[model samples]
Every structure is written in C-alpha cells, then in structure tokens.
Target: MRQKIIAAAIAAAAVVAAPQALASEELNFDAYRQMLADGNPAELFEMEGEELWTTARGPKNATLEKCDLGLGANVVVGAAAQMPRYFADTDKVQDLESRLMHCMDALQGIPSAEIINGSFLKGERAKVAALVAYVVGQSKGKPIQVDLAHPKMKEMYAMGEKTFYYRTGAMDFACSSCHSQDGKRIRATSLPNITTSKGAAEGWGSWPAYRVSNSQFWTMQHRLWDCFRQQRTAEPVFGSDVTIALSTFMAGKGNGHEAVWPGVKR
Candidate 1:
C-alpha cells in the first residue's frame, strides 16, 4: 500500500509539471496558426456564396434577392448579428440556418427535404450555405446583438442553456465539459469556452467558414452536426429544434460581438 501511494504521488507530480514542459511548444504552435491566417482559402467560398445569393436558379427560377432575414423583406446586410431572435411570423426564435430554410421554402418554393438531401459542397444546400456566407459577411465588423425579449424567445433561451450543459452519451460529454474552461485543447486545437461572451463571440462569429481538412464550406448547422457526431450522439435532423435552440444559446451569449462569416478555419 505504501509503494502504491508513492507511485500515485509521482503520477500527480508529472501532471502538475506537464504544462511547463509543453509551454514553449504551445507558443510555436500558436504562431503557426497566426501565419496560416493570412492566406486562408475560405475567401473562395465567400465569393461563390456572393454569386449564389443574387443569381437566380431552380424550376420556378427565382433568386434569393427578396428573401427576408427577420429584419424586413429583402434586408440582408448586417442581419446575422440579430438572429436567433423571435420572429412573429414563425412565432419562435430562429437561427441563421432555420431562418434560411424558411426563406428558401417560402421565397423560392424549394422543398426543405431537397435542400437537406443535397451535399454540403453541392446542390441546393450548398447554395443556402453560400447565401448564409454572403449575408453573414455583410455583418462583418458589426456588433452581435441577439434578442431574447419575447416570451417564447425567453423559453427557448432557457431550453438552450439547459441543453448546452446537459451531459449524456457513451462518452458522457456535454458541450460544457470541453468549453466551460478557458485554455483547454484537443489534438492541438484550442477549445474555446463558448458559454462565455468572449468565447461565444469567437466561436459563433466564425461559422459559414471554409474547413481546411474537408476543403468545403460548412455552415453553422454542419458545425453542430459534426460536434454531435464526435460526441457519439445521434445526428441531429438538419435545422432541427435542438440545433436551433443551441444556436440561440450561443448567439445570445455572443451579443455585442462582430459577425465575421466565411471565416477561415484550420
């Protein structure tokens, strides 16, 4: 028993000394990321998205030019920061992807299934992602300002907060486990604590981004789906209530930060 205790003490000492040992390596790694930021390929997707937004297509042959993003009809610029807010027509708080689905269905007469069935890099779904990129880009440099005033909006906010912290799955990992603390990392990627304003702004602001590994445009919905898959949870239905609720939580947390969409990702 004494020998076992001595071994445990050594193990604890090693963990305590680990960060100091790796500190220099961590600095070098962060510097590498800073270097990559200059020429990120996400700009390609941003350009494609801009074209898709105004270009007309489909059987009925309509562009998304007149699509409403909750501010009013045909208002695209700077609308992203205001999202995850309550919409009277829908009578619920909706996020970027859900709101985009609404516009695609109502304005273009596109079936939601067809859009969801489409690949992230091809077909109607890609177009929606592009539109999001363009719209969110317009809000670049503008402060994030998600509203939670309406009663239903408040309810959704509460639900979202609960969901963010609730842990269940084979891994027993909640979003908070990885993100509740600052300066944690997984596989060299710095995990931001998205529950806080600073972290939320950083994470939420940079979606509709180009992913380096996949070489494809990824919207917020795609980001969330991938997260769940990694968590070993059942995949969320595209733009489902749970996803939107979580988005509401993030967006509300990020209020007052700028929107920087079509962001470059490592």
Candidate 2:
C-alpha cells in the first residue's frame, strides 16, 4: 500500500511538471530562432523581391514602383502593415498577395490568370512570392493595423470567423482544432492560439515567411492552401475569397500588434 501511494504521488508530480517542461522547451526554441535570425535565408528572398519591385518587366514593361499598396502610388514603406484593406479600384478587400497580383495585372500587364493558375514558387507565382518577401520586409516592425471600418471588410472578417470554426473533411479538423487554445503542439512546433489577439498577431504577422523545413518562402495564401490540404478539404483557388476572408479575420484580430514579417519559420 505504501508503494502504491508513492507511485501515485510520483505520477501526480509528473502531471504537474509537464506544462512547465513544455514551456521551457518552447522558450528554448524561441532562443534558437533568435540565434538564427541574424543569418536567416529570408534576406536573400527579400533582396530578390526588392529587385523585382524596381525592375521593369511583363508586357507593359513598367516597374512596380508605381504599384499602389493601399497608400498612394509608388509607396512601399509600411504599406503592408495596413493591408487586407478595402481598395476602391477593385471594389474588394485585398490582402498583400492579392494586391500585389492586382498591381502585377493592372500596372505591369501580367495577367492575373497566370498567378491564379500557376504552381507556387514557379514562374509568375514565384515572382509574387519574392515580391511578398520584399514588401513584408519593409514592414517588419510596423504594427498590424488592418482597417475593419469598411462594410466589405467587416463582412470578410465575419466570413473568416465562420470559416475558422467550420469543421469538415475526413479528419474533422477546423483551424480551431489546432489553434483555438494554448499549450497545443504538433511534434516540435507549438501551435499559436489565434483566438486571442497576441496569438493572432503571432500567427498572422509572422507569415510570408521563410520555412526552414521546406526551404521555401511561403506567402499567407500558400500557408492557407496548405492548411486546407492538411485538413483534407478541397483547397481553394489562390487569392480566393475564403483565403482573403481568413486574412481579414486574423489581421483584424491582430490589430495593434507588431509585425514580424519576412520571418523565418521551422
């Protein structure tokens, strides 16, 4: 009976210690990332993206220096911080990737179909990824300030919230399954609980990032596509409304937090 009591005590102690252990591990991982931040390979992509922004290309032979990223023309500085906002020209709420595609089409004469239909990291889509890296790098320390004032933006945010909790597919997983709470992890990666403002900022502001595991820079749109694929649901088209809506929701939730764009991810 004494041995049984001791065993039970030991088990209880272990249960109590588990969360502390996980927290320590997460801190260690953050330190590791900080150590690697100085040499992050995302900088290469940023440089390439900057070049793409300034160089003339496509049928129009125009530089994207004139692209309107919710600021006036040719303004790249800090524009990404307020993105996923309403644009009157398109009569739509556009995220960074979609807005870049718009500029590529309207200003550079690269048809939107090329990006919508092309595979990621290939051809025109690849150019957009580089552009994303560049634009996001420009907004690294800026606050996420997505404006939800417009009726369309409010509508998109609502759709995104609905989509976030709607579960289907073979695994029966909604995004909320993995991201709605704290202390959840998949293998070594700690899942951010995006239901909270801080978590939403971490999840939303850190994307358009370089993934160390895949050796690829993934835009927010690409990340959402992968999320759908992982959920065993039909992946939406690139720049589809659902993707933009999700961006709006997360960005709106993350308003006032600092962006960590062009981030490096494991």
Candidate 3:
C-alpha cells in the first residue's frame, strides 16, 4: 500500500512538472532578439534594393531615381519615416510598398495587375519587398513621423481602429483578442497592446522584419495577411485600403519612436 501511494505521488509530480520544464526552455526573447540583431540577414535585401532602385527595368526601361516618395524625387534619406502619408499625385494615402507600386507604374510602366498577381513574396512581389526594405532602411534610427493631418490620413486611422477591434472568422478573434491586453503571448512570442501609444509604438516601430522561422523577410503587408490567415479570416489583398489603414494606424501609433526595422523576428 505504501509503495503504491509513493508511486502515485511521483507520477502526479512528473505530470505537473512537465509543462513548467517546457516553459522554462522557451528562452528569453530579449536575449535571443539581441543575439539575432547582431548579424541580421535583412541586410542582404537592402543591398538588392539599392541595385533595383537604379537598374533600368520594366517596359519603360527606366529606374526609380525619378520616382517621388512624398519627398522630392529620388530622395530616400529620412523619407520612410513619414510614410502612409497622402500623395497629391494619387490623392491617396500610400505606404512604402503602395508608393513603390505607384512609382513602378509612373516611371516603369509596370501594370498594377502585373505587380499584384503572384504568389506572395515572389517575382515582382519579392522585388517590392526588397524595395520596402531599402526604403525603410534609409529611415533607420529616425523617429517615425506619420502625418495624420490629411483628411485621408484621419479617415484611414479611424478605419484601422475599427478593424483592430472588429472580430470575425471561425475563431471570432480580433487583433485585440491577442494584443490589446498586457503581457499576452502565444508560445514564446509576446503580444503587445497595440492600441495604447507605448505598446503601439513598440509594436509598430519594429516590423518589415526578417523572420528566423521561414528564413524570409516579411513586409508590413505580409504581417497583416498572416494575421488575418491566423485568425481564420479573409486575407487582405495587397495594398488594399484595409491594409493601408491598419498600417497607417500602426505608423501613427509608431510616430516618435525611432524606426528599428529590417529587424529580426521569431
């Protein structure tokens, strides 16, 4: 009887200890993130982008040097910090990738269809990602300064706020389901309360990141698509208003934080 009771107690203790042991192995995110930051692979994409920016391509056989990024033409330095801003030419708010698409049309005559239709992050889409990296990298260490004064900018921020809290799909989960609260996470990744200014800045400031899991760099567009897919909701089309609006909101929230993108992620 005594032996059986001791065996039962040992079994119960092991069962209780199993989850804690696994949790302990999850690793310190800051430590791992710092380690990954040392020799980031995203730098490769930046190099490719610099070449693409000047290389003659598309039907027009022109480079993007003449393209305007809401700054003066071909001005890259510190331009990305104020992205998703309104463009007078398009009369629309444009993020980095969206603006690049416009440039591809205006300067290179690359049809929007040609640019939009593809497997995610391949061919021209991958080229766009490279472009995003290059442009955002130019703003490295600069404070985010998304302009919200434009009427379109204000509208998009409202829409983005709505979308963040809007819950749908099979799981009926919203962005807030995982992120609005403090110290929430899935597995090892910590979810930030992106609705708040500080959380929003931290959440928004460090994206267009290189994911260690898939060995591919992800743009902000890719990040949202994945989020919707994870929620079992409809995936957003590239450069759509919903995507732009969310990005606008994040960038608005991210304003004042120094850009830390082309960043490493798990």
Best by lDDT: 2
| Clashing residue pairs, backbone N/CA/C < 3 A, model 2 | none
The Cα local distance difference test for each model comes to 0.74, 0.86, 0.82
Candidate 3 per-residue lDDT, tens place, 212-233, comes to 6556789988888899999999
Better of 1 and 2 by TM-score: 2
lDDT of 2 by residue, 1-266 (tens): 64365345434533543454456645336654554476666777787889899999999999998889998887888999998999999999999899999999998899999999999989999899989989888898899999899999999999999999999999999999999998788877789899999999999998987665556779999899999999999868999999999999999999999988877676
Error of 3 at 241 (Å): 0.5
Q: Write the per-residue lDDT of candidate 1 for residues 33-145, one digit (tens) a residue.
A: 34435544554455666777677766557777777787787787778888877888877677877787777787778888887666655677777776777778778778889
Error of 3 at 166 (Å): 0.8
User: lDDT of model 3 at residue 126?
Assistant: 86
Q: Using Cα atoms with residue i matched to residue i, what is each candidate's TM-score against the true structure?
A: 0.84, 0.89, 0.89
Model 1 scores a TM of 0.84
